[model samples]
Structure formats: structure tokens, C-alpha cells
Target: MKTVEKIERKLPVLKTRKRVAAYARVSMESERMQHSLSAQVSYYSALIQKNPEWEYAGVFADYGISGTVTKKRDEFNRMLAECEAGNIDIILTKSIQRFARNTVDLLNTVRHLKELGIEVRFEKENINSLSGDGELMLSILASFAQEESRSISENVRWATIKRFKQGIPNGKFTIFGYEWQDDKLVIVPDEAEIIRWMYAEYMKGASRIEIGRALMERGIYTRQGKPWVDSNVKVILTNITYTGNMLFQKEYCEDPITKHRRKNYGEMPQYFVEDTHEAIIPMDEWQAVQAEFKRRRDLGPFGNKSLKLSAFSTKITCGCCGKHYRHSGKRNTAGEVYYVWTCQTKSQKGASACHSKNIPEKMLQNATAEVLGLDEFDEDAFSQQIEEVIVIGDDTLTFRFYDGHEVTTKWQSTAKTDWWTDERRKLWGERHKRKDTNPNKHLFYEFTGFIKCGCCGANYRCQSGKRKDGTPTRSWYCTGPKDQCHNPGIRDETMKRLVTDVLGLDEFDEAAMDAQIENATILDHTVTFHFRDGHTESRDFLDKRHGTPWTEERREKARESMKAAWTDERREAMSERIKKIRSEKKWPNP
Candidate 1:
């Protein structure tokens, strides 16, 4: 034991050291700055690894990242995280500016690293945060870095503003019809043809949707390879760029801090560069298309509504309830098809539904023809009545402003002179109860002025009903409410047939008038009717039921004839006596 104590053994000491890391950030990838950042990373890595007693950790570098604040610098933040986790005991960076240019960020981060037993060394400043007097030195150095950053930011702002003022465009927003080549607009021939076609077709009266469909059917896509849309067509039509002009600064981006992009409008200055690019659409044509577009838009809903149908299904109405009868053309097993009108209000309200009658489409058409005196036996009167009815209907069906509502005000029935109020129809069932006393009374009075509902003393004219097949059937109906009357309107087919018969037509020949017109030659108001079945008829001006080539003398004569026809013989004689002349041979001959 004494010998062992007297002997001293030499021991080898092993150094236990912490890993170190270096972080570097460059705001931009300019050639010189990029090389500088790379060199710093290499230098720091070698310096840490070369020490015999210490081990090399790693080096992190972030390019195109601002060093003004440590918060936004990814490499710096990652290094800090590692240091806080006790993996890194020291951090080396090129300079205070390279680490962080903001004094607040630098001081805060250094204080944080100090608490974690990690030290930060600024090479250029030759200072270490872990040193006893490091805080005082760091404050002075960080202030210089922040001032340098502010100067750089100001210079960048000045350069950007100067470039903008020199009429230089920024960013790389692509334009249609033209491709960018060497920073200049060059017309792509294929796209230019399509643009020309669009403008030409539009000015020639083709609609936007029609043009879009044509382009789509041809598999021609837009500059962005997107399917053509009507809105895009409209944009193309409105863009002045197609007319060889360029507009800049139509939009603005406010300061990032404020976060506002106010519209330039006319208040802000605008830059117009004319003839900067080849023209795709002519100016005159573009202007014309714009005008037409405005016109179509002004037409509102009517011009754009579907034009798929033209038949009795579109015309039949409920005589008693004042609702248009809906139609169904599907043939049943028996090969019988029907058109009927329904009460829309009742369908939604269930048990509280209306008891409106449904009549076939033919019935309403027949009724219209008969009331207008258009039957085969009355050939002359039929043609005359058709023309007169067309004139009156067209005149009556006009738009009018009523109580902030644009209403389609029209005569519901020509024979009865009943005007339909759209607002009244919409509010009908909601406010008023159906009168059971005279269910059909209002039908004849309101629609036909002749037919009357037999059961409830209501006018019997038009009513819509639903059949077992869920199809609407329209007919004249009792004016009574759903709880009161079951009277339905006459079948629209029956009315049509009767009216056709009244017109003296053997059968329903829709092409009769058209064929007659095609066969006859007219030099103004003269027309001759030739039936397909070999019957020919002619009417002179005096024999025409409706006044033609309307003249004051003809009008007066028609009034006299109507007066004589409407009054009794005794009153007629008195009218004839009061007239100046009965038969004048002094009248001019045509």
C-alpha cells in the first residue's frame, strides 16, 4: 500500500466540446452577393472543422432571404433552434448585417442564445455575445447594420420608382392574341386568325354564345388553352388591345403595410401606348360590337329567353282564374295527346290548391278563331279577322311601368277587351276568395263576353284542370273557389276545332293562309286566295271585311256600315237620312 501511494501515474485528458454552427443570409441572388454568401459558408465551415481540439458541427445558408430581421431568415432561425436544444454551443456568422440588420432582432436573439449557454460571434465586428462586455459592443455594431439596411432599402425604392416613371412595365403578365418574344409583343398567326374571326362574326350579328359555340366546336382554345366562354368573348370584344393600343397601370398595389389596392379610375394617371402591338380587331368593328352588345343588354330578359316553342301550349289561358294553362304533348296509349293549363298556386299549397279547370290546347285556339270569325265558310272574313286580330294583339301586348314594376300589359281576350294585370294574377289566390255563386260568370264576361258558367252563374270561358295522368287539362270553369265548383273549362282542342269551323275551313290546315299568300301576287294591299283543294276566291277593296289601304273615306264608310248593321232598320233609316249622300257617283276610281 505504501509503495502504490508513492508511485504517480500520468493520465491522458479528453476534451468534451459542444458542436458549433454558422448561419448566413443574403437578401437577393445577385451574382456578387451570391458568391460572397457561398464564400462565407465555406470559410466558417473550415474554420470550425480545422481546430484539433474541437469538432465541426454544420453550416446553414439561406439565399434570397432578407437579413433585416432574424424572424424571416430560415437558416438563422434553424441554427437558433438547434442552439436552444443544447446541440450547438456556438454560432459564427460573417458580420452583424449578415446575421441580422435590425438592432432589435439582433439584441433579442443574442440575449436568448446567452440564456441557452450558446454564444454568437460576429467575424467582422470581432465580438462575441458570450463575452462579458459583448452586449455594449453588440448594440453599437447592430445600430450601424440597421442604418446600412435602411440605406439599401431606400436605394432600391428609388431605382424601382425611376424605372416605373421611365415607362417600363414590370412583371410578366401574358397577353392573348400576342406572344411575348424578347420582351416584345409578336402576333401569333393562329391566335390572330381566331381573334379576327371573333370580331368579324360579332359585327355581322352573331351572338356571343353563338360565336363561343362555333369556336368550341372547332376545338379552338383560348391563349390560356381554356374552353371559350361568352364572358371571354365579351372581354375580347371590349379590349382596346385588340385595336392596337396598350394600357398600363389599370390596377395598383398599395404599400404592403397598408394592404390596399385602390382602383385607378380616372383620378390616377394612366399611360397609353398606341400602336405598340399589331391589331387583331379593327377599331370600327369593335365599337360597333360594343354598341350592339349594349343594345342587347338593354333588351333585358326578353331577348335572351328561350325560343324553343311556338304553339297553343304557349297561348292557352285559364278563363276563370286568369292563369295561363300549361301544356303536355305526350301521346297516351290511345295515341291522343293533350295540352292543359294548371293552377301553380294549388300545386305548392297541397290541400289549399285551386280547383282550376284544364282544357286542351286545341280548344283555346278554336275559340280564338271562332271569336275572330275565321272559318272556311267565311273565307273573306277569316283573313280579314286574322289580320285585324294580329294588329290588335301586337298593339296591346306592350310593356308599361306600374308601381316600380315593368308589366307586360296585354288584352286577355280580343272579343271581350279584358286586360290582364300581372300583379293581380300573382296575388290572386293570396288575397281573394273564389266566388262560388257564379263560377263561370266571370269566364264569359272576362274572356269571351258571351259564354257563361251554367252551374254557378260564373262566366264560362277558360279554366285549367289536372287529369289523372298528372297532365294539365284546360277548359272553361266555374268562377267558384276550389271548395265550391268543379266546372272545368272547355277542351282547348274543341275550341280550336270550332273556331276553325267558324272560319269555314273544312279541316285544320295551318298552311292554308301561307299557301294562298305564296300563290298570290300582291302590289300593295291586294291579295288573292287559292286553296290547295282547288278552290279559288278573290275579294275587292269594297268586299274586304277589314278596311285595307286605310283611307278617310273608307273608314267613314266602314263606320256607316257598322252603324247600319248594329242598329235596327228604323234607326238605320234615320242614320241614312242624316247622312249627306247615300250613293255618290262622284267617287274616284282606283
Candidate 2:
């Protein structure tokens, strides 16, 4: 045994070559990022190919893509798939954050590779997966990476808030009436005119829907060169920005994972920077618009009422429950429409909230008319003399005068069915007909003026076309240069419906809508309306594709159709369509 050991000689141990792959990622889309990403790819590729003990597997690189999730990283996923197929023995990547900002994603991927007897080498952290303490170290480091990502996000949010606090524009944020010039909101005169016109129109009783349609007719397109809608008109009427004030943090991201933005609504701190720039809308006018906005909301159930001067108009209130008495339409035996006021709670929520009696509109008018010493309902006189009428009981009403006098009266319901004459019927029918005849009348808001293209400052005009059903359809078209502004017109009615929905109003006030809205700006599929009331709202329009989304069966049929259509030559040609197309992975993303 001693003689055999003395004769033994050391020999070189042969090493099995590793199939090595490298991955790289860059999160930004800037030119600098492109250079950085290219450098990373080149570096990793050279490093892997030059290794003597490693067989070069293809380099995987994801550009302008987040490392937080595996879903969006196409190349990263491809590399993993190759590893799962036993094509790769080792993978080299930059660092934990570069690989994945999520700890779970990093741990799971690393563990999966480990189970396949593949090693993951983190170049920056100098970590190897096969080591005993590798997983423990990776878990701790991955946690740090995730925390760093969160910290970066928080820092960005905090910076934005700090900029808002300082009343400094963080970046080029612009509205229709203004452009971001040197980080300042500079007013565009023509656009400002449109803003003023919108506010005036709304204040003059134009509804948002009507205003959107009117803007379309005037060839005023949105920022992205789309048609105007009611919602667009409403947003203009409500946005405070036109008043030279900026409201920051109206929304906030709820979590770092989903990046879901939620409306501020007291969830986070909000910053209001007053007098930030020259105002397109006067502050007083904006305040008036807000007051009107609230008043429109107060309309609640009555929806829109005729602008007829009457003592019964918004005069009754429930003193017991402190709720407004809503006007309800009723039909008589004569087939005529009459009206009565009931406690809103009783009418909407049943009698459980307010057990009050309904008051006839005619009776209320007569009582108010008598109290005001007028033969008819004089809104001016009533406003000047009597402050509010409080309903203590179904039949009991207390009229509180501005002079501090309270008059209690017992009101009895009377039949005013005779008031509905054929003439009155014509008036009501006219209002309804007016809504139907005006194509611009697509929305109930019916406010005119506003909505322009943000890019070219051009107007959006209405264009008519025939649908497949052989029916005529109206869409908005931009007046901007087609090559410059790639905006497609929106369906007029679609915008109107959206605007009406946003305003939360029932169709009635054909004249009242113009008095509230400011102006609307369109971009992409969204319309942002700046309101005279210093509030803003958004409306989205999506094109209605003729076909539904493809199902599994439909997709298979599509594949078969493609197979049938493709010849050997065509398949070869398709294959030559370059990896650039594959690299440009976007929506319809897998």
C-alpha cells in the first residue's frame, strides 16, 4: 500500500463546461438609457463569450422595461424558459435591483434556477446561488432592493410635494389656455378666449354636453386633436387652473406594487397654489361657477326645470329633517301633467326618514305669491324679502323673512289640474323636441363653446359618415394638420353621454347648462375640462371595435387561418421581419 501511494501522481481534473447566459435591463427610454442599455448588453455578451470554462448562451436584454415584475420583461422571461429547458447551466446578471425590485420575484426565480441545478451569479452583490448561505444572503439583499425601490418612489413623491409647496412648477404641465414655457404656464390668447367663452356659455346656462357639441361644430378639437364632449365642457367649467391657481396631489398612488392611483379625497395631503399665473377666468366668476355647480347638484331629483319665473321654484324646504322638498311630476284623470313637492327623504328613501305631507306646486306658488305680495312668483322679490320657507309638518310651513320675522301658515293641497293647457303641453313638447333635433343636443348639459386640440390649438369640427347599418353617424374631426396631429374624431353622442354621466344630472335644463362650464381640452381618448368653478373633470372615449375580444377557440381559428394563408416563401419572408418587431413589445403584450 505504501509503495502504490508513492507511485501515485497528481493529474489535472477535467471541468464540465457551463452553458452561460447573461441578462441586462434598463428602465428608462431616454437616449442616455439606450446607450447605457447597449453598453450593458455588450459588456455581458463579451464577458460570457470570453469565458474559457463556459459555453456562450445568447445574451438576454430588456430595454426601457421595469425589473419589478417578470411580466413585462420579455427577454428575461425567454432566458428563464431556456434555463427551464436545461439549455443554461449558469446565468449572470448585474444586481438584485437590476434583476428584480421585488423580493418575492427574485427569491422565486433564484430558487427555481437552483432546483434545476443552475447557478445565478449576481455581479454587483458578488453572490452565487449554489452556496449554503447564498439564499439567506439573497433574501436579505432582495429585501433591501425592494426597500430601496420604495424609498426612491417615496423620495420622488416627496420632491413633487415639496415643489408644490414652493409653488414651483416641477415640470412642463399645461392646460388648454396655457402652455409650459420655461416651466411657467403662459396663456395662449386664442385659447384663453375659448376658456372665457366656455365659462360665459356655462354661466349663460349651457350644459356640458351641449357645450361639447357646440365646440365640435366650431371646429375646436382637443389637445390630441379629438372632438369635444359634454364631459370636456364640464371639466373646463370646473377646473381651478384657469383661475391662475394650481391644486397639487388631487390623486395619489395607493401602493408601490400595483401603482394604483386613487382620488385624493383626504387620503393624502393636497396643495393649493393660488395666483400661480395670469388667470383666464376671473376668481369671482370661477366662484360663481362653483356656486352654480353646487346649485346644479342641489337640483338632485327635479333634474332640469324650465326657466319660468315662479314662486314655487326652489322655495320649499323640510324644517323637520332639513331637506329640500323635491318637485315630482304627477298625472291627473284628464291626462294632464301637474307637479307637487314632497320631502326628498320621504320621496327617495321612503317615509321612514321624513313623515311629511306632499304640497301641491300650485298651492305653494299661491302661498308664496301671497306672502311676497305679488300676483306671480317674483324670484327677485322673494329673494330680497323672504329668506327660506321651513316645513315643520306636512301642512305646516314657517316663512322666515330676512327681517327676522317668522310667519307660520297651514297649507292645504288644492287641485291645479286645470293649469295644464294644450299651450302648456306644446311648451313641454317643444323642450323635448329641441333636445332631439339638435345633433349638438346629444348631451343633456347642452352648454356651448370650448374644447380644442392641445397640440395645434385647432378647433374640432363635426364630421358625418354612414355606419354599416346604413345609418348616419356624427364624429368630431380636428382642423389641425393631419400629418402633425394624429387625432381621430370622437363620436358626438358618446362624448355627450359621458359628460352627462359626470355631471350627475337628469335631462331638463336646456338653458341652465351654459352657465357653469369653462372649457375642454382633448388628448388621446381623454377630454380634460377646466371649469369656471375651479374644478376639473375627465372623460374618456374608446372606439367601439366591431368584433369582441378573441376567445381561446377564436384564437385557434385565427392561427389556423394564418397557417392556411402562409406559404413556405411567405413564412420565410415573415421570419425575416427582423427582431426589431419582436423587441418592440408593447400592448397586446404577453
Best model per lDDT:
2
Task: State, as a TM-score between 0 and 1, how close model 1 is to the true structure.
Answer: 0.39
Candidate 1, residue 72: lDDT:
61
lDDT of each: 0.61, 0.78
> What's the CA RMSD of model 1 in angstroms?
29.0
Which regions of candidate 1 deviate over 4 angstroms? 1-10, 68-86, 101-115, 130-150, 171-173, 190-243, 247-270, 281-590
Question: How well is each residue in 415-453 modelled by candidate 1, as lDDT tens digits?
Answer: 212222566444443222222223343433222322334
lDDT of 2 by residue, 445-516 (tens): 342234567667676766778988899977766778999997756776776776666667675343444455
Q: Model 1 misses residue 349 by how many Å?
A: 33
Off by over 4 Å in 2: 1-19, 28-35, 52-57, 63-66, 69-89, 111-119, 129-134, 217-219, 230-234, 298-590
User: Per model, how many backbone clashes are there?
Assistant: 59, 59
